[model samples]
Target: MWVQLRRSARTHVASVKGVAWTLFLFTYTDYKTIFFPVTAFACVAAPVQSYTRLLHGVIWIWLNLLQCNSSNQYKSAEEDALNRPWRPLPSGRISRSQASKLRWSLVPICIGFSACYGWDVVLANAFLTLTTIMYDELGFAGHWLGKNFCNIFGYVTFEIGATKIIGTSTALDYTAMISILYSALVIFTTIQTQDFPDVIGDSALGRVTIPIKYPEASRKFTFVAMIAWSVFFSSTWALGTLSSLIFCVLGAYVGSRIYLLRTVQDDKRSYVIYNVWLLIAHLLPAQTRWNVLPF
Candidate 1:
């Protein structure tokens, strides 16, 4: 009986690992866009949480990210076949039915993991779930307003839940709140950066993204938003002049290139650059948390 129990335990462990690895495949290309921002936000906001605790929180974040990515990719599988044929669905790594089952199965697991942190995290999980539905199922993603807002809100939920889990006290301070709110605005304004690369796919699908619906205006808007946020964030964070200058240059580089570069390949590279700037922007608060002049 003891041997039987041990065998069962091993089997369960292996199953859990299998599920985890499979989930990871769903978001394999999103490490920069999803993982970095969430990790940086948790690190900055949960200054008192030990590294081990923070790492655990990141694991939970990835699980939720996987679910989000799976749903999104499933919804846009056809578009993905055009723009990103290497994805799990387009590449034949997983079938539609199996992916759908994994998507729903992940909800309870995400909620269960959040419940370990408390209601706040669970609420964040709920919100993210709701946003996913509204974005994918409710036709929000087909419009510019819905897509931008959903992306920002979803990102903020990730930050909130991760911070709460690993926070010193699970209560955000004034700085934390302000920083997150500010980041949300930045993301909302610039979330369209992602859309530029998928113009062909989006247009083919009749998805009315900013870049597709208003190409000229959207490029100019990205330039303005990026530069504006660079200056404003330096001020808001009270960064030093030198720090501010560097940040502005990074932002300007991304913004200007995005405006000037019009090729599909150019947009793709520009989007990657934008994400790098975004990752840095998310990490800036670490300087704030440490009370160091990261400006």
Candidate 2:
């Protein structure tokens, strides 16, 4: 009986560790991406002064991570088994039943958090949650257009929720709208590069991502997207936004790297470059607030 109890305790600990690991991977990467929208709202609507507002933002970020990770893992188990076999769900570290229970549990908590803010916040959360369900369960990620649409809408909802936290008015100003649109464009154009590394798993699953659909043109498309990205930010810099200048330089550098390494089929290197590019892009809003670049 003591041996049985010890084994049970070890199982529990392992499950906990798996959950923690999954959460860390889901929340930590591009975690700063959440800050971009929140900061954008804070800059335009109101600065984050109170702990209450700050807590609201934090909750949104956490809830977003929970919702995305749970739903994506649940639906993508088969694909992950091929591409990311080491993931908690695919690796047998966490069972599908456990993941489902955890995923559903987050829904009520997210709603409760939103309720504290207002109906608009609740609606935003609901919209995001619903779309995420559709994106994964409905297999929208299988196609290029559907995937991009879902991603862009997800970012919009994220911005809406964050902005609603600090601003009395739900309506976005021109600058805020521009910022959101730019973010969406960035996702729509550049996010597909992430699929380059998963081509094998993606192809096996018949997922029609850019890399899968346009095998020959995918590299050129990414390069052009990066160039466009650089040009857009450079224009902003030209208008005296010093932060934009920094992004302009980083974007150019990243774009050039993409161009130079376009022929390399190394997934790890491609992912590293993509991650760095995304990090810099997400940090741009904070840079705008800081005005770190001296003109």
* C-alpha RMSD in Å of predicted model 1 compared with the true structure: 3.8
lDDT per residue for candidate 1 within 120-220, as digits (tens), equals 99999999999988988898999998999899999999988888877787899987798789879988899898889899899999999999889999999
Clash count, predicted structure 1: 1
Local lDDT at 113 for model 1: 89
How much lDDT does each candidate structure score?
Answer: 0.86, 0.70
Worst 10-residue lDDT window, candidate 2: 38-47
Which whole-number lDDT from 0 to 100 does residue 2 have in model 2?
100
The C-alpha stretches of model 1 lying farther than 4 A from their native spots are: 1-22
User: Using lDDT as the measure, which candidate wins?
Assistant: 1
Q: Which ten residues in a row have the lowest lDDT in candidate 1?
A: 286-295
Residue-pair clashes, model 2? 0
